[model samples]
Target: MSAIFNFQSLLIVILLLTCSCAYIQSLAPSLLDRNKIGLLGIFWKCAGIGE
Candidate 1:
């Protein structure tokens, strides 16, 4: 039960993170490009959206 709850929370966190990253990418491509951010860049690249 506790494990399930933790998993759900982790999943929600990941979803939120992904959505926020997408929003940021849409809003500020230059910032993300210039800084070469790590996790978000990896996520977008894996999603086949980013370079």
Candidate 2:
């Protein structure tokens, strides 16, 4: 049960990170923008949207 909860929490974090990526992209492009692009794609394929 704990393991399953942990996995769910991790997915939530990923979704939040994806949201941040979108926010950052809209706010301003930066060095981290490159990595966020890849992370966004990965999260979309591996998880669901949170925002």
Candidate 2 lands at a TM-score of 0.48
- Model 1, residue 5: distance off in Å is 7.6
For model 1, give the 10-residue run with minimal summed lDDT: 42-51
Tens digit of lDDT per residue, candidate 2, span 1-51?
553479887777766777865565556555344544564555433322323
Candidate 1 on 1-51: residue-level lDDT in tens?
553479887777666667766677788766556545676466555223422
Clashing pairs in 1: none
lDDT of each: 0.59, 0.54
TM-score of each: 0.58, 0.48
Please identify model 2 stretches exceeding 4 Å from their true place. Answer: 1-5, 31-51
